[model samples]
Target: TRHDFGSIPQGQVATAEITVRNTGQGALKIEAVSTSCGCTSARVEPTTIPPGGEGRLLIRYDSGLHPDSGPVRRYIYIASNDPDEPEVEVIITADVQEPTS
Candidate 1:
């Protein structure tokens, strides 16, 4: 999955709310939520999701943690109990604009 914050001002925080669904026949348990950089953080609501149910993946990216004022990319990893795919990868991106004085 992928989420783009588009263009945002420097020294700002951007948020992305993603819907996570369990399409399998068994319960989906979210084991862990991690990010590639300290600039980003995320969490999953209700950790355990029933079959066909859905949850929310709330992510926050702070541009202040990242210095470069251009396109940037980060990652979010979600470990789950899915048989086919145990780990779900989310690519988060943003375009950071210079702050105006």
Candidate 2:
């Protein structure tokens, strides 16, 4: 799934959860997950998901590092056994704002 987190204040910790499902007949394996910015971090569970199963990608943002108000985007790459859904890219987006000083 994709998300547009709107906006967050600076120095605030932001997080997003991306859930993926294996709707195919074979097992699903996630090769890697990449972020658009260094201030963002992500982690996946199991690294592999069974057929007809679901998995989650947890992403965290260090707003302290990326302190601004605008649009931001992050991407995650997933690799699976199913040819039809062998590779998938998930997106996360948000706007960061500076915390009132």
Candidate 3:
């Protein structure tokens, strides 16, 4: 599973795509996706993903609310049915840019 973020601007909305694949032979049920901060929001595509299949989770961060620092970091909490990896955490990082003249 990988989270890809395209180019984004400051004081704008940045989106992240969280992908999950059922590498195992069993079906995977995603309990939920939580965010570390309120400025960050997340939504899952399908609640369940079949074996050998994949699912997507969308996360958006309100960059406008974040401080105009170098980089903003956040985490995504994932709950799944995979035995070996029931729970997984993903990291998100973005460099906020200042408005130019």
Candidate 4:
């Protein structure tokens, strides 16, 4: 899944939510959630999702760590018990704008 935060001010923290659905017949258990860099963090609520149910993943990025104005991309890795897809990647993008003096 992918999420775009559009434009945000530098030094500000940005957040995005991603929904994970369990379409399979068995329950989905999220084993771990990790971010690509130290500037980003992610967590999954209700790590277990019943069949046909859904879960929420909260992702936070620290724009201040970038220290520049430009397009930024971050990734979140989700490890789950899904047999078909044990791992999934979520991408987040944003255009950081410089603060005015």
Give the TM-score of each candidate. 0.98, 0.81, 0.85, 0.96
Ranking by TM-score: 1, 4, 3, 2
Question: Which scores higher on TM-score, 2 or 4?
Answer: 4
Residue 36's lDDT in candidate 1: 98
Assess candidate 1 and give its lDDT.
Answer: 0.96
The true-versus-predicted C-alpha distance at residue 64 of model 3, in Å, is 0.8
Give the Å error, residue 92, model 3.
0.7
lDDT of 2: 0.74
Q: Per-residue lDDT of 48-67 in model 4, one digit per residue for the tens?
A: 99999998999899999977
TM-score of 1: 0.98
Off by over 4 Å in 2: none
What are the clash counts of all predictions, listed in order?
0, 1, 0, 0
Give the alpha carbon lDDT tens digit for every residue of 1-101 in model 3. Answer: 33535345677888767676778887788887898988788866788888898887788888888667466778888887778987788877777777666
How do all the candidates rank in terms of lDDT, highest first?
A: 1, 4, 3, 2
Scanning candidate 2 in windows of ten residues, the lowest lDDT window is: 76-85
Which stretches in model 1 have alpha-carbon errors above 4 Å? none
Quote the RMSD, in angstroms, for model 4.
0.8
Better of 1 and 2 by TM-score: 1
Q: Top lDDT: which candidate number? A: 1
Candidate 2 to truth, TM: 0.81
Per-residue lDDT for 56 in model 2? 84
**Residue-level lDDT tens digits of model 2 in 46-77:** 78888889888888877777546667777766
